[model samples]
Target chain A: MTYINSFRTGLKEGLPICMGYFSVSFAFGIFAVESGLTVWQTVLISLFNLTSAGQLAGVPIIASGGSFVELALSQLVINSRYSLMSVALGQKLSREVTLPEKLFIAYGNTDEIFAVSVSNEGEIGTRYMAGLILLPVLGWTGGTLAGAVAGNILPAIVASALGIAIYGMFIAIVVPIAKKEKATALCVATAILFSLAFKYVPFLSFVPSGFTIIISAVIASVIFAIAAPIKTDEEEQSNG
Target chain B: MDNGKFFIYLLVMAGVTYLVRMIPLTLIKEKIKNRFVLSFLHYIPYTVLSAMTVPACFYATGSTLSAIVGFVIAIVASFFERTLIQVAALSCAGVLVTELIMNYV
Candidate 1:
């Protein structure tokens, strides 16, 4: 793809991800501020971190004066899946994308960004990646700033309503795939079962939410991966 | 924690997260060959999102009934393949409307 064409395609594809991030990060801003983070601190978290779940998990740790080791471990555990995604995405980059650009692109490789980038046909270029990352970053930081400032001013009804927006987006992403694939449906169902066990089971309920997510995801994926592994070379075969 | 300490924490958090994303993309030029691992990675996003959504989404709206209403609305919208923003907005609207009705009652 030429630079302008690649960048424009990226901006077009990134629009939805940008909008999705706005609502989710907006909720994060309010939640973080409510959990005792300053507005600036909350906004800065969104600006630099960019991972919603990680930032959401990190705020409480920071607020409570948790140890650095505790913070780092939590972040690693919560964000480890990104390593897999980055590896998957790396193979898709066009050769014109340099080492430094890859490093910068890696910074914005959130789940949605990775999904959008990897689903595109052929090699992904530097400008395309840059364009794709731009709006979501802006939306994330801007939404956090807006939500932190509006936390007090927004009525209880509106504030509470926004809480479900992120979950709605999550459902939007997963449900469509689950609908199309039986294996995905089974994986999601199993994960939900594990998630509920962690929430309600005695003793198990004490596990931190971040760890709960990782454990559930790992177990569910393992079961399905063993029972119904996808072709490893599936990506190389353009189905068209 | 003080500002300096907080900044340090944020830096560590960002650094760890960034490295998790950066190192693999920068270093791993070859496509993963392991079938199990590829399948695991392929399934991870859905599983993680599912695990996160459930139980937590039930408590999201602060009222279980409204949360359920929103959840159902989101699921239906998504089942119909609505855009991400459309599903999110519909669900939020559903929750807000439900809350308003509950309050009036």
Candidate 2:
């Protein structure tokens, strides 16, 4: 495919992802403001961080007078999976993607975009990745703008109801695949159990939320990897 | 926090996050041949998402009952194979109705 064709393909795939992001970040926007951030502060967080959970988690801590160390540590832990994803996506890039281009593209490696790009048939080129990142970025910023700027205009009940939106996105992402694959289903259960245990248990509750996420994901992924190893990429594409 | 501190906070967050992404993409040029490792990474996304989601989901709304209703609605909506927006809209509606009912009940 020509660069334009690949870019167009990227936009096509990105449309659904963009829509998903708009709602999720819309939730993030409302929460950020509710948590004490100004509209500009909230929008800037979404603009630069471009992460749903990390920003959502960080803003609250900051609002409550948490230390800078807490903010940094939590962000690193919550988002560490991106490092692993970066390695995986690195292997899929075309040779034409230079070092700067690779680094540039890597900055926009959100979960939805990673899944879409990796599922493509061939090595991903710069143009395609650019297209993939573009729409989602716009939707993310746009949604945050709407939520932060016009959130007060929304009726109190509607704004409150929208709090469920991000969790809804998470459910949308996980449920279909879990329903199909027993192992992934098991993995989700394991992660949730681990998360709850850490949260409510006596001594374990002291574990920071960032570390808690890493431990749960790593521990559960390790368990399922041993029990039911997925040997092929074909199985993965189907899982998504 | 003042503007300077918040600025520093975001800058650090952005810097570290960019490194986490950039370093891996720049360094790992070859496909990892180890199936054990690949299998492990295979499960990371789902597990991470699941870990981030829960307990939080249960307490998201003003009322626990409304939040639970929304959670259930989101799960049920997912089984229908609807688009993301569809699922989100339905679950939000479910939460709205539940919250409104809670006002009276």
Candidate 3:
């Protein structure tokens, strides 16, 4: 009963995430097919990668006959934050979680799962996180398959425009939190400024997109940490 | 990349990604105690999401004006703490309206 309830809750909580994943993954599928990948290959990549940005960055390299090392480094640069997210999640999880369960849950860690899990209270068990993971993975995979099957049916302009859904989803996730939290707002502003600097500045213009994202995130995180460290217990208690 | 080699590369990449995510949990029995590290971990999602979204909002439509309109709409909608769907719908609608009016006038 507990497992069933957790699954139900996960499904409900994950609906919006699933919708966002579907749209973005669908776009990826369309792009993959147009890039000359077969349906099976596209589906397999989505299932294994489960990362929009990483896949987007990698697809060009793969098409261009880039080396495996280049592909791996690009993926590492883009998806390195998942390591941080996983560590945070590991801290939130019960210490008693078995090795196998931890391994399984780690595979399922994505932006959506991390957001939903971290926002919830208390020690999150593997069971509940698993419920959250399964839904989005399935949604993403299914959506990719659908997109590949329906490839190029829509006009190129429309399909290209729909790619903006990924950005829309990111905005929906960040804007609300930034509005309420000063630390988050600062982090957002710093990241944007640094990203623009990397893009527009003559010397920085040569930096790759994947590296730019990683560097901006690191710089923003550091600045926010220095400027606004977490409040102490006495401060919190006094305020309360 | 040939078909066989591409699949092989993907399998290796997936294995490496999974290992990077899982190894710390499996090996590190002690809790993370460093405050700076913990705080950095706490802020990664926020920083990454913001980094992705901010530029995207401004650049997604290939014009600074559209991005500003989209950001304004998204910011207002997000203040209400609405669901992702609602925020996305409202922002897209906002972008379309802004673009249409710009074109007509």
The number of the candidate with the highest TM-score is 1
Compose the digit string of candidate 2's lDDT tens values, residues A25-96.
877877788888888888888888888878877898778878878778778887898997787787678878
Best by lDDT: 1
A37-97, model 1: which lDDT tens digit per residue?
8899888889889998888888998998888999999999889878877877887787667
Residue A46 of model 1 has an lDDT of 91
- The per-prediction CA RMSD against the true structure, in angstroms, equals 2.7, 3.5, 3.2
Residue by residue across B2-93, what tens digits does model 1's lDDT show? 67887898899999999999999999876668898888878887888889898999998859999999999999999999988899999999
Position A82, candidate 3: lDDT? 83
Question: Which residue pairs show backbone clashes in model 2?
Answer: none
Q: Is candidate 1 or candidate 3 better by DockQ?
A: 1
The local distance difference test score of each candidate is 0.87, 0.82, 0.75
Model 3 / residue A16 / CA error / Å: 1.0
Which digits, one per residue and each the tens of the lDDT, describe model 3 over residues A1-240? 011227667777777877778877887998888787778888888899888888877777776667888878878887887877887888777765788888888888888678878777556777777778887898789989989999678655445445566677777777777787888788878888898888889999898877787789889888777777665435566999
Model 2 chain B lowest lDDT segment of ten: B1-10
Q: How many backbone collisions does model 3 have? A: 0
Q: What would you estimate as the lDDT of candidate 3?
A: 0.75
- The true-versus-predicted C-alpha distance at residue A239 of model 3, in Å, is 8.1
lDDT of 3 at A229: 67
